[model samples]
Target: MGLNHINLVVKEVDQAVSLFADYFGFSLITNRNSKMAVLERSHQFVLVIWGQELNRKDEIPEYPENFHIGFYQEDEGAVREIYNRLKEVEGLKLDSEPKKIRNTFGFYFYFEKLMIEISVNPFKENIA
Candidate 1:
């Protein structure tokens, strides 16, 4: 079987669900108040967003440096398109403009507590 769902713990489930819906076209499958949500995209990819609750304040979760979720576009232009779209979102943190990184053209940005990377295809050769 192919890959299944990905679960992310975030500070705000409502905001996170909205972000995915607005930017990635994911639709909400279900929501448990503001505490959690299940989102689906492409009919196969499932994303779960979990929010902090009062009782769970003692536990701390951390991601390693450079840890991020990446979205790959077909080419450099598509990557730039998403870059521009995200730039218009007020309060979203964009680390930098899209630039050549290793073999891909992309940029890094953050939404709330999550780090995100957007890149063009990294396997192909001679792509600008």
Candidate 2:
């Protein structure tokens, strides 16, 4: 089976949605106060956002090193593009540079308490 999607616990759903819409090419499809709010790209990769109470009930307590959301960039240049864009984005911190690791190139950035990684998915096989 394919990896379905990840749900983020966000205080501000609109802010979180807009941020991804603006920078990561996401477009909103549906949202609810309690149910998951969904965003999709042209590729149909989905991002689901959940509110606070739901998060407390459902998600595990994350450690500092673990991120709630992670994105994989297509290639090194795409990773760099985001690295440059991070300068203009307000609420983010760089975890590492857009450099090579094994067969992938990537960088990690944080928004509030959430850490998102952008990297090349180097495997040709669909393990997901």
Candidate 3:
């Protein structure tokens, strides 16, 4: 079976919701007083963001160093388009410009404590 959804716990649920909605084309499905939100893309991928309360400790969740969420683009140009758009957003810091990474063309950035990767698959033909 394929993956269904992903849940992320962050310090600010509303901010994370906005980032996903405004940039990644995820539409808000439900929002619970800024403490949690459910969003879905046109392809049915669901992303759930939860505030610190979800942990029951009121502490901000920390992700492992290499842990990140990735978004695949159709081509290098699409990857660059997203990179350029994110650059115009004040306060958002991109790790670097889109470039060759392993066999893919992409870049990485952080929104709050979550790392995000936007890339174009170089081995697209290899996948079914």
Candidate 4:
């Protein structure tokens, strides 16, 4: 089995959408009001952000340092580039540097109310 998508319930969909699109180059596929937006990386997978019904901080899950979304990358150099790029962002916390993992290279980082991990990898075709 494979993973389909990750849905993040956020307090500000616009903010989250822009952060992903601006930082990671993902594009917005659609928006359900200002409360929700769907982002896509090519045609493969999506990250959907759904905002608060009442706009209350207590209502949404707080972004934690350890909680993150990880994406696959093609090479170590590319992974390190991302790591350096992310270093400029204010108040960002990282779990680890971009490093090799089971032949994949990537990093994990988190910011206020959001977390992400992006990498480059060719789509895996079924092989035996």
Candidate 5:
């Protein structure tokens, strides 16, 4: 079977929802409450964001050093377009401009505690 959905725990559900909806083209499907939201992309991918308040601990969640979620674009130009748009966001910690990273052309950045990668693989016909 194919993969279904990803549930991400973030410090603020609304902020995460805005990032995915406004920048990544994800449509807000529903908000379960102030603590959770569901988003969907054109390809039927679901992204669920859960607020940190649901956790038993009282601190921020920390992912492994190199752990990140990535989105692939159709081409380098598409990747660069996203990079440029993200650069204007007030407090996003973008690593740098898109460049060759191993076999892909892309860039990385942190939104709150989540590290996200936007890239394009030149050799791949389908980027999904």
Candidate 6:
């Protein structure tokens, strides 16, 4: 088996849902009372968003300093396109512009408390 799904706990469910849907092209699979949402990408991968209610303070979780979700494209141009689109997204914060990182072209940014990275695998064309 590869991987099933990932659940992300966020402060605002709608914002997180919108951001992911816009960037990853996910389709909303389920919406539960404005508190939870399930999104699907490519039919095989699932992303579940859980809203942390302020009334339940103890249930809120913290993320590690470098924790992030990543997405990969096939080419450098696609990565740049995503970076540029991210720059245009209102209220979203970009950590930096796209640049060479090791052998890939990529960039990272913040979506609320989550860190997101999108990159292109430079060696993809070399794979047999």
Query: Which candidate number has the best lDDT?
Result: 3
Q: Model 6, 65-114: lDDT tens per residue?
A: 98999899878889889888889877678878898888888988887778
lDDT of 4 by residue, 13-115 (tens): 7877877887777899998888778899877778888787535554646765557676655566777887887787666677787765554667667655567
Q: How many clashes does each candidate structure show, in the order listed?
A: 0, 1, 0, 4, 0, 0
Q: Write the per-residue lDDT of candidate 5 for residues 1-128, one digit (tens) a residue.
A: 86789999887788889899999889998987868899999876899998888885656678889889998898999999999999998768998899999988999999887899999865686546
Candidates by lDDT, descending order: 3, 5, 6, 1, 2, 4
lDDT of each: 0.84, 0.73, 0.88, 0.72, 0.88, 0.84
Lowest summed lDDT over 10 consecutive residues: which window, candidate 3?
52-61
- Clashing residue pairs for model 3: none
Regions of candidate 1 where Cα sits further than 4 Å from its true position: 58-61, 124-128
Model 2, which residues run further than 4 Å from truth? 31-36, 53-68, 124-128
- Candidates ranked, most accurate by TM-score first: 3, 5, 6, 1, 2, 4
Write the residue-wise lDDT of candidate 2 on 1-128 in tens digits: 76667677766667678778888889888878634588988764778877665655544334466534657777778889878888677766777778886777887777656777778887845666
Q: Supply the global lDDT for candidate 3.
A: 0.88
Q: lDDT of candidate 2?
A: 0.73
- Give the top-scoring candidate (TM-score): 3
Which TM-score value belongs to model 2? 0.70
Where model 6 places Cα greater than 4 Å from the true spot, the runs are 58-61, 126-128
RMSD of 1: 3.2
How high is each candidate's TM-score? 0.86, 0.70, 0.90, 0.65, 0.89, 0.88
Q: Residue 123: error of model 3 in Å? A: 2.4
* Cα RMSD for candidates in order: 3.2, 4.2, 1.6, 4.1, 2.1, 2.3
